[model samples]
Target chain A: MAEVNRQILLVSRPQGAASTDNFKLVETPLAPLADGEVRVRNHYLSLDPYMRGRMNDTKSYAAPQPLNEVMIGGTAGEVVESKNAAFKAGDKVVGMFGWQEFGTSDGKGLQKVDDTHVPLSAYLGPVGMPGATGWYGLNRIIAPKAGETVVVSAASGAVGSVVGQLAKLAGARAVGIAGGAEKCRYVVETLGFDACVDYKAGNLYQDLKAATPTGVDGCFENVGGDGLDATLARMNAFGRIAVCGYIAGYDGVPVPLKHPSLILTQRLLVQGFIITEHLDVWPVALKELGTLVAQKKLHYRESIAHGLENAPEAFLGMLKGRNFGKQLVKLI
Target chain B: MAEVNRQILLVSRPQGAASTDNFKLVETPLAPLADGEVRVRNHYLSLDPYMRGRMNDTKSYAAPQPLNEVMIGGTAGEVVESKNAAFKAGDKVVGMFGWQEFGTSDGKGLQKVDDTHVPLSAYLGPVGMPGATGWYGLNRIIAPKAGETVVVSAASGAVGSVVGQLAKLAGARAVGIAGGAEKCRYVVETLGFDACVDYKAGNLYQDLKAATPTGVDGCFENVGGDGLDATLARMNAFGRIAVCGYIAGYDGVPVPLKHPSLILTQRLLVQGFIITEHLDVWPVALKELGTLVAQKKLHYRESIAHGLENAPEAFLGMLKGRNFGKQLVKLI
Candidate 1:
């Protein structure tokens, strides 16, 4: 292993939209493994939309990501050195290792996983935080009944892709709202959703209405602009909405719901959730996700950025919908 | 008791704001009571804000109020004549009798209420639909715990008065937002709310922020406008908002929530409900409401209009915040 650790830090807060200038990359000496500490060599750094919210100094589900710190993130890696009794060398693990090539933990929050069947990087997407996020939003919040219709925005992204597939698995009709025709095809053909609406087609409301013939009974909202507005218009009475993210409003603009009266008219139950606040569900979510991956029932794609230096651009691209699937930085 | 029934009919739909012109007075020949039917002489006609929503031909929780028919409403009256064994003459009951001097029911929806301890009109306010509405939204949706702050809009209105008192009874801090100083005084002094903010004071956000120092944990929203928007700004993390009505938007204006991001940032559960959809809670809700009114633990106020021909203006006044507490028309 190397003595030098390459890491990225949040240097400044974004004014409107995030850019690479807001982040800085530096090389520092890796900390030695102290007593009861384990050294992890991070392989993949997960770039999610929630990070954009943390970049602003606003009150949110989480505190603002402090400046001049290793950017907060999820990582999947192998234990290079261990001083804790619970962990051993060469153990594949996952934790909030942040945006760094090396991390030191006391094995407290680190979760050891079996990478024999599921790949190590897969834990950062399908069987990890994003996976658990999708699971909790769909299963715990929406709770789709059989034959019900579930519509998910950002349907090709990590969390939403899983929501659509899981909705189908629950015997509910799964419809997706994606940005492009290419992503829409992948959502329906690869992800096995019942139908897909390409929001970029400039016919969101009409297309969404046509896609959901019966009406949307449950919604997994990832983006909160026209896609969500259109979905709200087509919602059935007593529909449930799990607001996992508002990627459209992360640019520091106050995004308003156009039809606030619809909530009462439709009798909708709209709930917003942050996955980090619900750690109690990980064991249940991970077990099912891992089993599905091993059985080839769950599939996830990733857009890989090669170096730690490119993490800032990768993050900005993810926020602007330029990156497809789970955006990950390869720090190895 | 009478050969003809004097009634008000919805002759036209409102274009923007509901006016007296939409209603017409007509005396119709009463259909003689058939077998298994009961004739009710309506003593009190309950005028609520929800009637404004039904005046428009829009998709809502309940269907539109059909034109050229008696305006839909709740009524408390005496059973004048009965052909059903389940009901008898001189019995005090409550049901959806619409806006008229008399009503005939098949005894299916009629509720036999004991007005010995609770007054007949109190059944329309406290031990009735509005009472049950406050009960369900508070006990079922918000579910405020001890020491939590519960804020309600339209605080001096029928449903809001009960919610504030109920919040205090549940050991929570009750904060209210009313339109003027008089209603604000009644909310804190009569209804026993912890604090009442007069939205007309020109400092809604600042005043509400002062009233809820610890931040609002639960909100019972009746009118959607600046009051709700101000409450959203002061909401604590994991706050619960039970939306019962949007009187501000009933004028056919689209009301947009200024900060929809707050729902996600605060991790709130904002649900809109119609009490009619939840019949399961009526028994439990009415039991508590009835006992409270009977024991004089629950206090209510009403502004009664004299005749059924004036029901349209009474309704328009209630929608504009002219009437205090329950807006009931004395049809006796």
Candidate 2:
């Protein structure tokens, strides 16, 4: 058994953009588990854009991540040791284990997950928080009807990929906006989106217009820069926009929407939502998401960075649109 | 009846700010009414800010006011001669007679009303489209619960006055944003809004923040610029914003929403609506509004100019915040 545990701690808050200097890697002896506590060997650490928001002490739906604490994150792993009757050795679990090699929990938020059909890493992507985030935003907010056109920004990322697929499952026309040609191709070919716009191709407005010949009816907005501005311009009358993430504005400045007058002219409905605030939906969401994964119908890709020490780089890369899919770090 | 019918026509579209040069006052020979037509000598003309958007040849929910034609406007008058059996000669009626001294209608869209209790011009302001505008946005979109704070921009104007009054009736704390001290006073003292922030005071953000101690739960946005930007900063979680009008962006430019990231952090629902698009609700909305006005429960004010030739000036002044309430022109 591993006698020592390694963890990444946020040493300081970010001034503008976060860097590895803001975090410190530390080694600590694994404390003996208290009564009714279970120890987990975290296999994969989920690196998401939301973590960048947590790095700053700004007003947000979720509380700010404190300094000198293990960086907040989602993890999927196997139970290595247990002092609780509910958990046993080798049982797969999904929990907020954060950026660490091991976690000790009283089994409060820990959920026992099965990996008989779906892979263990997938619990961190599909059938997990990201999957549920996509489901709630698409289903509850956007509510795309059959034959309507739905556009998703950051289409290659964890949440957006699921949104496009589910939008397709709802029989709506799914379109995607990604940063590159390769990711855009993958989005259309593999995810079965009707069209994909490469935003980095230098003509986002024209490309998106060309891609969505019919104006966008529903939009899952993950990137909020020129992509959102262009989407606002092309939206049909009475369109719906689900504001999920704004990776472009996560640093010190809040990105301004360039054309807000479209909200009046087009009569659009723009709603912002936080997935964590809606905990009541998880049972139904996870049931559907978990079933799709078990049946091998849900398609997903991963960009895995080996070693816990490389998590910061992978997360920072995902913010820059460098990672192709779900960004994660493999600890084992 | 007058042999010559004088009318104001939109001769040319505005380049930037509209002026008297954009309209041409001409006297035309009154056309003879057809068998099914009714001729009405208009007494009042409603000059609204929406005319500015139509003058600029810009994108909007309504089509641009056509050039070289009688300018579009709502009017109230008594039917002077009736060829249609449904109308009598002295019956008071309301119709879109534009900026003209006389109108001939087939009675398709004309509505006869009883003015024994409510004034004739009240149909153009409170018991008319403007009143219904306030009703739909406040009731359907904002839907504020008791004790929730609702802020309305341009609170002294035609639509805004009604919005604040309706919100107060719904048991929400109504805060208004008006242009000057006098309008702010009227918004609070007469319209019964809980508070009014004078935007010309140069301390909008601070004053609004002080006024809404519990934060704003709903916003009825009429003028979109710094006022809207400030309101966005103060919105609470799950706030609802009904985007009714952006009078600030009416001429050749669209206003951008600064700090749009607040939409995500606050989890707001921002929807834009055109009152003209909602014809079905007018029946019920006007009934409630008319009863309130007739019973003197709803107070209203107006800025009236006395000639059709002066409508261009009145409209421009209303757009500049010179008018205190519903801007109108008395044709008689």
Top candidate on DockQ is 1
lDDT of 2 by residue, A1-332 (tens): 78899999999998888888999999999989999999999999999888998998888898899999999999999899999999999999999989999999999899898888888888889788889999999999889999999999999889999999999999999999998899999999999999999988899999999988988999999989899999988899999999999888999776788889889889999999888888989789988988988887778999999999999888888889899889989998
- Give the top-scoring candidate (lDDT): 1
lDDT of 1 by residue, A1-332 (tens): 79999889999998998889999988999767799999999999999999999999988878899999999999999999999989999999999989999999989889998999998888988898889999999999999999999999988899988899899999999999998988999998899999999988999999999999999999999999888889999999999999999988998788888898899999999999998899899899999998998898987889899989889999888887788898999988
DockQ of each: 0.89, 0.85
Interface RMSD of 1: 0.7
Residue lDDT tens for model 2, B1-332:
77899999999998877888999999999878889899998988998877787787766788888999999999999999999999989999999989999999999899999999999999999999889999999999999999999999999999999999988988999999999999999999999999999999999999999999999999999999999999999999999999998887877666788898888989999999999899999999999999999999999999999888788889888999999999899988
